[model samples]
Target: MAWSHYREMIVWQKAMDLTDEVYHLARSLPKEELYALSDQMRRAAVSIPSNIAEGYGRQTDREFRQFLSVARGSVFEVETQLEICIRQNYLSVPDAKTALALCDEVGRMLTTLSRH
Candidate 1:
C-alpha cells in the first residue's frame, strides 16, 4: 500500500516502537550513566523515527533514501549501545533481549524501505 505520511509507514511505526522500548530499557540503567550511555541510547533511539519522518517530508526519493540510511545507522547505534549495556551489567539479559528484538525488527523494516 502507498504511504501518505511517515506515520503510515510500517518502518516508521516500528522505529517508534523501538525507540519506546529503548527508552524503557534505559530507565533501568544506573543514574551515573545519565549523561553517558543512557543519553546516547536515547538520542540514537529518537533519531530512528525522527530521520524517517524528516525523510518522508523531503521532496525526492534520493533524499528519502539518504535519510533512511541515517535512520539505519541510528538503529545500529542503538543495537550497539544495548549490547554495551548488557556487557556493562547495566541492563538485564531479558530486558536487553526485548530491546534487541525491536531493534532487529526496525533494522529489517528500514532495509526493505530503503531499497524501494
Candidate 2:
C-alpha cells in the first residue's frame, strides 16, 4: 500500500511508541546513568522512528531500505540496552515487557519493509 506520510505507517507509529516507552524507562535509571546508559538507550530508541521518517522522505528506494536497516539495527541496540538495564538491576523485567514487545514488533516490521 502507498502511504502518504511516515506517520500513517503502523511500523512508524509503533516505533514512536517504543521511543516514548524507552524515554520513560530511562528516567527510572540512577542519576549516574543519566549521561551513560540512559542517554544511550534514549538515542537508540529515538533512532528507530527517526530513521524510518527520514527513509520515508528519501528519493530512492535503496535509500529508504538503507535507512530502514539502520532503524532495525537501532532496534537491536535498544533491546541490548534494555537487557543491560535489567541485568544491572536498573529495571525489573515486568517493567520492561512493554518496551521489549515494541522492540520485537518494530524489528520485525523493519525487516519486512527492508525486504521489499
Candidate 3:
C-alpha cells in the first residue's frame, strides 16, 4: 500500500489504542497531579500518534522519519513518566508494566519504519 494508505494501517491504529490507554491511565491520577505528571503523561501519549499522523501528511520519507523520531522521543518520555509514577505510588506496578510495554512496541515500530 502507498504511504497514504498505510497511514491508516493497523499498527497506527494500535498506536492510537496505546495512546488512549495512556490517557486513561493518566486521568486516574490524583487531582494534585493534574497539572504536573498527569498533564505531561497526556501530552507525551498524544504526541506518539500525532507525530505519526503529522509525518504521514508531509508525504516525504525524510520528514516522516523526522516525525517518527519525535514520536520515539515521546515514547521514552512517557516511559520515564510512568516509571516516576510507579516510584511515587501514583501508578501500580502492573499498570506501569503494561504502559511500558506499549511504549516499547511503538518504539520498535517507529525504528522499523525509519530503517525501511
TM-score of each: 0.96, 0.98, 0.91
Residue 116 displacement in candidate 1 (angstroms): 1.1
Residue 52 CA displacement from its true place in model 3, Å: 0.3
* Model 2 ranges with Cα > 4 A deviation: none
Model 1, 27-69: lDDT tens per residue? Answer: 8899999999999999999999999999999999999999999
**Comparing candidate 2 with candidate 3, which one achieves the higher TM-score?**
2
Q: Rate the local accuracy (lDDT) of all candidates.
A: 0.90, 0.96, 0.84
| Residue pairs in collision within model 3 | none
- What does candidate 3's lDDT look like per residue over 1-116, in tens digits? 25456457555776787788888898889999999999988998888888888887786789988988998899899989999999999889887777788888888988888887
**lDDT (Cα, 0-100) at 48 in candidate 3:** 88
On TM-score, the stronger of 1 and 2 is 2
Give the number of the best model, judged by lDDT. 2
**The candidate that achieves the highest TM-score relative to the unseen native structure:** 2
- Output the lDDT of residue 85, model 3: 91
Instruction: Please give the range of 10 consecutive residues that has the lowest summed lDDT in model 3.
Output: 1-10
